[model samples]
Target: MIPWIELDSAAIPGETGTLRLKRRGDEFSIMLGANELMNSRLSGSEEALAELSCAKLAGRKAPVVLIGGLGMGFTLRAALAVLPGDARVVVAELVPAVVKWARGEMAAVFKGSLDDPRVEIHTGDVASLIEKSKSAFDAILLDVDNGPDGLTRASNDRLYDAGGLGRSGRALRLGGVLAVWSSGPDPRFTARMEKAGFATEVRTVRANAKRRGAKHVIWLGVGHR
Candidate 1:
């Protein structure tokens, strides 16, 4: 049996808790208290987050995409796989350490996706970027907090609120997509997406690629400008 090894820990910005990085053999996990925020082995849902959202931007030439959270680059790698070479992906990661871990200890997991010419790393709040933009993105994929119920930081709740969703709508180009990944479903979040003038679809995906694990939720919304 392999034992879990703690690789590193960093405090959550503007929050009291810390995020712990651990590894057991080839598997890695980012933990916030007792909850696992992300795991290297279970990347299906995260990959689906990008696949489903990028599919919405299929014919759009040179699309600009915004990805919130840099968990393990699963979504980023997935998006890069589907998007054309001219497309741009801007990833906003709230915690700087997460980014460090990505480029450092977790580089193998990321597979150099961060170095892709089409990818940009924003070491700040995703909300700030969305709030200040107007139709600047073709797609916005959020894997921020655990499904809207947010287990890491209290500020993450704002990203799922009505006002936040409104900003996201305005940040995206007409007919652009906004995809959110969650550990579970949130009915209110779905309702809010609709109220924000988006035609929403809810999807249940497996946590791992084998399609045999805990069911996770992904909400895809196409904004109507």
Candidate 2:
């Protein structure tokens, strides 16, 4: 078995912990402290995030989507696959190094999703975008941190709170959807979405496409029409 090799490291802004990129042959992993945030080999839930969200906006013309976190670009790629050619995807990644890693070492993993004409990369907080934009996006896919609990950065907690959910709802068009990816389940988060006027549904998906890995959760919150 090939040992994991640390390719590079980057500090998480506003947090003491660092994100380390490691590779074991063709497989890649991104770790924050002791927690493995994402892996190239396990992207089923990430892809599902985009697929499920886009499903809600299927008939919308040139839908605008906001993706919170680039990760390995699984969500972005999946979104581009299902969305129409004119649909726009805005990806907000807080960590600049993560974006660099995606374009550099993890380029192959991303498979040129960054170069897509319809995709835009924002190296800033997704919350800011949500707060500023009113009824702008047709779908918002959030894969930031571990879940609503915030494992990478404490500030990410606001994105899952009631206020944040309100901002997200306001930022979305009528009948828009907010899809969130989590390492595990959080009933409280679902309730918070409901309180913010979103019809929510939680789905459990396999980490791997083969359906052999641990189950991850995705919450689909549909905005009021």
User: TM-score per candidate, in order?
Assistant: 0.98, 0.98
Task: Give one digit per residue, the lDDT tens place, for model 2 in 1-225.
Answer: 899999999988788989999999999999987889999999888988988889988888999999999899999999999999999999999899999998899999988889999999999988888899999999999998888867888888889998889999999999999989998898888899899999999999999878879999999999996
Off by over 4 Å in 1: none
Please give the lDDT score for candidate 1.
Answer: 0.93
Among all windows of ten consecutive residues in candidate 1, which has the lowest summed lDDT?
Answer: 148-157
Assess the local accuracy of residue 159 in candidate 1 as a C-alpha lDDT between 0 and 100.
80
Q: Go through the candidates in order and give the C-alpha RMSD of each one to the true structure.
A: 0.8, 0.9
Residue 181's lDDT in candidate 2: 90
Pairs of residues at least 3 apart in sequence or in different chains that clash in candidate 1: none
Each model's C-alpha lDDT? 0.93, 0.91
